[model samples]
Target: MDRRIFIKNTSLATAALALPKIDPLRSANLAKNNLPKWKGFNLLDFFSPNPKPVSKPTTEDHFRWMRDWGFDFVRIPIAYPYYLSIDRTKNITSEDVYKINPEAVDRIDSLVSMAHKYNMHVSLNLHRAPGYCVNAGFNEPYNLWKDNEAQKAFNFHWAMWAKRYKNVSSKKISFDLLNEPSMREDMNDQLSKRSAVPGEIYRKVAKAAAEAIRKENPRHLVIADGNNVGSTVIPEIIDLNIAQSCRGYNPGIISHYKAPWANKDPDHLPEPKWPGQVGNQYLSRAMLEEYYKPWIELTKKGVGVHCGECGAWNKTPHDVFIAWFSDVLSILSANNIGFALWNFVGDFGVIDSGRADVAYEDWQGHKLDRKLLNLLMKQ
Candidate 1:
């Protein structure tokens, strides 16, 4: 189970299978724009909407291991509230949003620097923006899409980050404007009915934010998450010259499975099976291909695309997760699109994933899912 032994065993097993090496030039030709198919993981050190501790800090070992294992990118999905000094007991006012805490900023700066130190491209994303979040938990003073105050604050925060990393090269860093843009009936209700942000409104907000960022550094790369919680492509923003981000968790039934946050009644959901029946619906790779058609077409239009987050929770059977995820990665990789797993060391990662069926190997005191790691390395 040691790291070296695991690698040795995996290498021999892979050789026995006689898998072909990925052709670099062929992969490069699949991409339409300058975007490289960056493959890596999302580090959740600052992902919680609440300021309190939710996840641990990412260490240098993560970067080193990822680089050693053949990954070149890391997406840091941050919740704005994590870095701002605000009274969590009350709704955050526009003024309260600007109370920037130097310590939190320093911690974030360190993360960006550490990722760069290992030659990893960092894509900074606002998972929870000033006025909006897909999940329900915190109270917002104003609506991002309907209120002027929230829009202003959203632009302000992006502008601040733009200025903060203005000196960094676009090749090494990019900004994912927001995490999953959607309109929910109630911002504080987790189960609130949700829909995509109106195309015009989404375009307006993205345009303004892109302008703010460009003002600081015109060469800085910018990306927008797909409308409707990262599922549907935003045709409205294609002309904005900004890239778009898509999700990997299509057909929530598979990706989410028994995740409480994803389903209202996780207990009642049918057991998941790849390319097989689950509940009344039959799921298959053909369905996945249909789902990603829009995203793949977006690439043909010369718009850069990336799967910012993808991975199933630990509850799903390990074999099913691998089967479904392999199809997801294959579809994306074939089109020259890249992906980042939801995390690197938690419930949806290669290390310490906590899946019941996985035969975990030990690596630097962490339980490494060698099978999952091998699957990821192949693409």
Candidate 2:
């Protein structure tokens, strides 16, 4: 059956109050059935500093590349405010958010439809939500947790998506709700107590957003990212019956040695190498597992777990990234979890990760890293 027709006829979008509940047997079945082994890539261009209008043909080309490369889905990380105005000056009012940005809505529709055409899933993520972001020196004007206005904006954006794409198949479309919510001392430096904690605010805002989305369409497999850039701590919203997502970039010295946006002090960090000595200890799969143990425990608790984003920045050596990636992918697969690589075309992508040493294959006006591609395909 054609996937589009299948999605339409199945009425997969409408929902009852069936948010994920903790039933080990049921969750295990869901893991086998609903949760696909999503070998995916994040379409991150829309989240760039100066967001560009996405062309349909560009998205189609990307879908084709991903399908041809054995990937099954695309994780789209879009900044919502980019849709609010061309100049990005709109202070979205409660009444104004409901006034959907037609251009943005159409673009998302096109992206999702194209993914369905390729028989691929779409995990739509708000990398920059109304109230928070992991990027340095950037933040929304209002506090999402503390301010009713910001929470309304957050809920409004997601609810609009749920209602808009309510009929899309859960298999084909899911939500990654927010990007990495972290405790950054740099952002809003002297904020109030409640507003200061990232996890606490994330938890409240996520609950509200989840409730809003589910109200629109119940079965959306909403995914909430971990605190501190998808690291060790899972949010307290597990009881909300939503999926948990984590970042796989472990041993900062190796995975994020000198990542531009990372908050770590580069001067104090050791040089990175996979299975090489960082200090007295070697960075290996075992260490990665130790960091991942908490997230794995979440899966054991009957909520779906996915590594929503993971990849080495462009500066990391190609050989080292491949090795680290292999370990990360293997461990996630072994545990029956789905993961999406950070991107497909830019800094952290499989095709355009910008490794200085290798020759790149030009495809559809973009360069492809074939060696990395081969490594990814072999997995």
Q: Give per-model TM-scores.
A: 0.91, 0.81
lDDT by residue for model 2 over 147-205, one digit each (tens)? 78878888888998888878777888888888876655444442322222455666787
Candidate 1: which stretches are off by over 4 Å? 1-33, 53-55
Per-model lDDT: 0.90, 0.72
Stretches of candidate 2 off by over 4 Å are 1-34, 54-58, 86-99, 136-139, 186-201, 233-235, 263-269, 279-281, 359-366
lDDT value for candidate 1? 0.90
| Per-residue lDDT of candidate 1, residues 39-126 (tens digit) | 9999999988676755556899989999999999999999998998877878777799889888888889999999999999999999
Q: Highest TM-score, which number? A: 1
